[model samples]
Structure formats: C-alpha cells, structure tokens
Target: MNGGVLRVKHHLVGGFSTVTLCPKVTDHVREEIKAFLLNKANAKAALQMQQPAFDYDEEVEEPRPSQPNLKKRKGPMDKFVAPTPPDVLKGRKDRKDIFGVCDKEERDNACRAIAKWFYDAAIPFNAANYDSFKEALELVGRYGSGFKPPSMYELRVPFLIKEVEEVENQLVEHKTEWAAKGCSIMSDGWRDSVVQKDIINFLVNSPKGSVFIKSVDVSEAVKDANLLFSMLDRMVDEVGEANVVQVVTDNASNYVKAGKFISV
Candidate 1:
C-alpha cells in the first residue's frame, strides 16, 4: 500500500503455522526508508555526544559487594589513622605533672637510698627485674601514672661513677689536711675468692681516719720484691714521702724486702 507489494508464504513446522512476507519496494519507498534510518542514526549520535563519555581521570569508588550478615573489616591504614585512647593522653599529662610537683630533695634522698640498698647489700643488678621493681615502686607511691626508674646502665655506670668521684674528692680534701701531720701506711695482699687472683690493698691511717689508698693486682707470675717496691714507692710519692711516718706490711718475705728498699 505504501508503494510496495508484499508476497506471503505459509509453512507448517512443529505443528505451528509460520508466515513470512517478502516486500517488493518501489524507488520512492526505498528512498523514504533510507532517509528515516539516516535521520534516526544522526539523532542517536547527537544524543550520545551531548551526554558526555566516562572520564578516565576522575576517581569513582565502586560499591563493594557485601555479605548478607557480616561486618566490614578495617584496612591497615584505617587502623593506623585511628585516634589514640583518652587514657593515654591523660597519662602523658599526669606524668609531667607528677615530676613537676615532686620535691627535688625527696627525689634525691630516694635515689641515694636505692643506691645504698644495692651497694651496701652487695646485691647484683638484674636488668630483667627493672620493670617489676619500677611497678612496685609505683604501687607503693604514686600509681605509676608518672614514675620512671633509673636504667640498668645509669645505675651501673654514670651514676655510680659520679658518686665515687664525689666521695674521692671529699677524701682527697681530708687527706690534704691530715697528710701534713704524718700517716702510718699499711699494705696487705690476698687472693680474690671468686677469681682466685692475688691482690694487694694499701691504706693510710692518719689522726683523721684510715683511708684506702689503692689496690694492685699481683696475680702475675712476677710477684717479687721489685713489684712490691714499685707499688709502695708509688704510694709514698702520692702520700708525700715526708708525711709518711712508718710503712707497715704483712711479714711476707717479698713485703719485708720491699720495706727495706723503701727505707733506703
């Protein structure tokens, strides 16, 4: 009817009739169909251009597929960026305040007491016990909110060295005063029980008190009169030869000879 003739054919397959149409189009109808198709294609292309293509540069988060009844897990970076606990912040503040409020003299006295406990009792230090000891001290005083203990290294080295130097200075002052009045010098040797090494210790007794001078390790095979004489001579030079009233030593044969040599 629209400038085209339709031819129809009917066939039976699988117990159903199927009809097919073959249209014989005229030149005018064929041209009309081509124009409509071209217009529709052009309109489709314009619509696509107006709507914009997906941008490869822009980031778009894809929705994650979720389980029916499970919580989402946190990523490593999310846990890292999480806020710190309130108690941790409070503890840091409390620590600074505790030190600021503590009396310096009391702190010094406590440190001395701790040193004496380890020194006088001859108790060896164990680094492993530090945390437990620190906790105990904290429990006894302020609740660990702001207390720290001396490290094992500080206790063994710097602090002990400082204390020893202070005492040595005091002793030196005392000796300078008393050495002028003359002092009796004594020497004795013994073997260390632990390492079985021979050691000789020297002391000077003045009107003030008996003060230890020095110790020499005589464990070498060359423990003879010359070694003894040299050790005693060094003491004489240190104590001042004129201030030494008498030199005394155990009646060991080597010490007896060393005494005679010094007397000369």
Candidate 2:
C-alpha cells in the first residue's frame, strides 16, 4: 500500500529506490509466544467441553418477545484507543537449501510476521479469505527471502503500471464479446457516506462479463436530470450507441427521468 512517484523537473526517473526490511525478534520472545499459544489452545478445548448441551428434543415452543433496552449506550470515545507507532520491518534470513524444512521456531516467527503486517496495516480480517491472498503468499515463498520489496516510488510507477496492464489484458476478452453481441450500458449512482459525495459508476455488460468503465464524482449535477441524461448519452456514444442494447440505472427519480430521456 505504500506508494508514490518522483520527478526531476517534470521528467520521470528510470531507477527505482528500494528498502531492505529487517525485523528482529529475540529467541526469548518467540518462546513466550509459543507457550502462550499452547495455553490458549488448551483453554479453548476446556471452554468447549464446559458449554451446556442443547436439548433439541424438548423444545418446539415459540420464543417470547423481548423488550428493547432504552438505556443510554456508551459513547464512541469511551472505547477509543490511540494508534501506536509500527515497529521497523525486517526480512527473515533464508535457508541455504532451497527445499529445506522449516523448524518450529522459524515457523512461529513467520506466522508472527504475517499477522503483524495485517494488524499494522488495518487491513480487513476477511481479506485473508480471498484466494488472491493465498496465491500471493505462495508466490512470495518461492523466492524465499531474496525478494526486495519496492520503495514508494517503484510501487506507484512501475508496479502500478504492471497492475493496470494486467487488468487491460483481461478487458480485451470482454471487448471482443461486446463486438459479437451487443452489450448493456449499466450505471448507478450513490452517495459515498465516508467522502460525503455523490459518485456514479458505469459498466459495459454482455454474455461474457461486465467491465467497469470508470467512476465519476457527480455530486454537483446529481439533481439535474438534463445533465444526467447528457452524461449517460456520452457514455452510450463512447460504447457506440448502435451496439448498446439498453441503459440500466437505479430507480432514483432523477436517474429514472434521465434514463427515459435517453430511451427517447
């Protein structure tokens, strides 16, 4: 996520700046963590056994309605915790043997690091559930410890360009399908509660799949049906009006009028 670009008087630099990450944890700390985790596992097992057994056979009775608690809830500030500074990162020493076995201490240290990065970054817990996360770990493991992570400049410039190229490669297949069978111009607008702005997203969909064109901040003209129609019209023109089968948008009053005007 750390990324940026640098320019010398409006021209981009060819060479990338790299950072060598080295996180150091003592062997004593590793032992403490291992012992604590072992205790936690045993505690979890005991708690599961102590739980009350459910009697499904005895109860088919309707549940009683409960009254809502009107008592004042605790304020958000009461539970707030200030963020702490992150520790310096370090790359673990790689094994000499390419197919070497990892010992218990090494394995524990690796797990500790993986969890630490996620926590420090404030990444969503569910992000680990995605297949891409697993694939990324697998790919990185192949290189062992020799991988030099990109500096902020390299990530935003070179790496960013690589990611865009990968996405564009995938979109090419969808564009081919669009030429064969007419595609639908799907669009929707909603207020982004965080940024407090109205934004619209446009996509082209066919039997193959949908490809998101772009997102636009439309807060200024959200209420103007004529402007909305014109925006949608331009999108249709971009995708080729003759090839577009339909224009799909939300049922919001302004959007409905805009869609109707486009249809006419």
Question: lDDT tens string, model 1, 153-254?
Answer: 999999899999998997887688666788888999999999989999999888878888788887876878998899999998988888889999999899
The residue-by-residue lDDT of candidate 2 on 1-264, one tens digit each, is: 243321220012111123111135354553454344334434543453456343333211111111011122233442332111111011223423532355446777987998899899998889999998887666556333555666999978997999999999998888777778989999888788998998889999999888999998877764678878988999999888777999999888888999889989
The C-alpha RMSD of each candidate to the native structure, in angstroms, is 34.9, 23.5
Model 2 misplacement above 4 A: 1-107
lDDT of 1: 0.62
Candidate 2 to truth, TM: 0.57
Residue 107 error, candidate 2, Å: 4.2
Question: Number of the top candidate by TM-score?
Answer: 2
